[model samples]
Target: MTVMKSVPEAAYGILLRNQCDSALDEAVEQVRNLGYAVLNSGYSDIELQAISDQFDSARERYVDAYGEAKLRSIDEYHSVRSPLTHGGGVFLNLAMNGNLLSVLKKLIPGKFILNQQNCVINPPQENYNQGAWHRDLPYQHFVSTQPIAINALFCVDDFTSENGATFVLPASHKAEAFPSAAYVRKNAVQLEAEAGSFLLLDCMLFHAGGFNRSQSVRRAVNHVYNIPYFKQQINIPNNMQGADLSPEMKEILGFDYMEPASIADYLLTREAKKY
Candidate 1:
């Protein structure tokens, strides 16, 4: 004779297995319930160093290309946009990490696009543009049944109280309107995490970068991944044309979701096109 557990018992066992099998289940749940979560990327010291170096080089190259005056004039200073186009392999590798992707897959169903990837630097004791509270999907004031996008910010340096770490209003993703100032003051939490850890948040969550009171600058790489229904911040497939990328990465970057040029093109399958 054999015995089978009840439905609730079986479900509990499956959930336990999922939690144990992947270290990210709890973190994912936190993001679902609280609008944010901190996740470790599990990269080695040497790898994290490479990523840091890449971030510095990318920012320098961007400044050189655009000129500091031009960047400041446009209010885009200290930020490197689309670093993956010019950054080293480490940047791309971090974007394609299996663990991070796994957490994303759990949160967002179906195909998603890399809306944008940029490097942000917070200067010590200086007022930065991102210091104010805002949602990643700015200007939108509605709540969705599920997350439309996720922001995975990789901390290049250890995020500390002195070095501007991120701060968020917990569970604000469920609220359609921003909370009162008094509520924010009481509920806001500063997230301090080690280098190489990701400060993951729902795109709708209201978050801001804390002021860096330390003597050193703090750097972070931000990646916004959203469902393909929304347009990318930049035309990634067109911008990174001729660049070598794995098939999965290509699809994730919106290669498969690009709009067709003509009726014939529209009729063709995604694979048949040369995009």
Candidate 2:
């Protein structure tokens, strides 16, 4: 969201530095100019740094638990890619998926969920060839006229053109249909940024990972935000529901006192049912 158009970009930037909130208008402009904008910001540099540190830690630990080979298919540029591309992940189980949904209920206090089940990814083959190229959640929600997912790709390392940074087809969301590989081959834009820089791409944009021949590792975290009407790639309210939620787990799911009626509801609702 944006703060206000009347607020000078300088003021807005200051506000951003001080956690000044954005108005939807400012957000719209940011989106128009940069394709995406920061919604809410944290405190100091150390605070934001800590968030990335913890996020990276979680990723490495998870990889340790699940062998790199197991998720290799996910990192592929073509083919099945990420199961989340179709809605599945390492957190597919009942207890694990359930606990997560419950806690989102609280932090957001409504029904916003992180849907971490679909968050896993391993990266391309060590050789790092150019990707097949595609879009993120190109599918539209039944209710939305536009592409449903607002994608945030968090850089886990300094992204460079040589090391397979993710690429985006600028303004592809407005395209009526996905382009042929030949078209993407003709013109594709890479999104290169420093580690800690978050690139938000319109989910509909045709995209892929560039080849990475560098010795350094390339890593990233992508979060897809969508409205409730779209079919979720991963089922959030799957096996666990009802009273199965622990209080702490519910807090994480953003669920307070009730089980979500549907997976979509569990993920998109910002206003929880009031007691």
Instruction: Give the winner by lDDT.
Output: 1
Q: Write down the lDDT of every candidate, Cα atoms only.
A: 0.90, 0.48
Model 1: per-residue Cα lDDT over 11-127, one tens digit each: 433434334355698888899889999999989999998898888888888899989999999889978988887777777788887778999999998888898998999999899
Estimated TM-score for each candidate: 0.90, 0.54
Which sections of candidate 2 miss by over 4 Å?
A: 1-27, 30-60, 68-130, 138-147, 231-275
- RMSD in order of candidates: 7.1, 10.0
Q: Compose the digit string of candidate 2's lDDT tens values, residues 1-275.
A: 88756644543333333232434345444444345443322234564465445545555655665656774656533112222222222222221333222222211223333333223222444544336556666454222234345565555466788788777766666665767778776766776777655555556666677777677557655655444444444444443456455565454333442346898877655444441
Stretches of model 1 off by over 4 angstroms after superposition: 1-21, 270-275
Model 1: lDDT to the true structure:
0.90
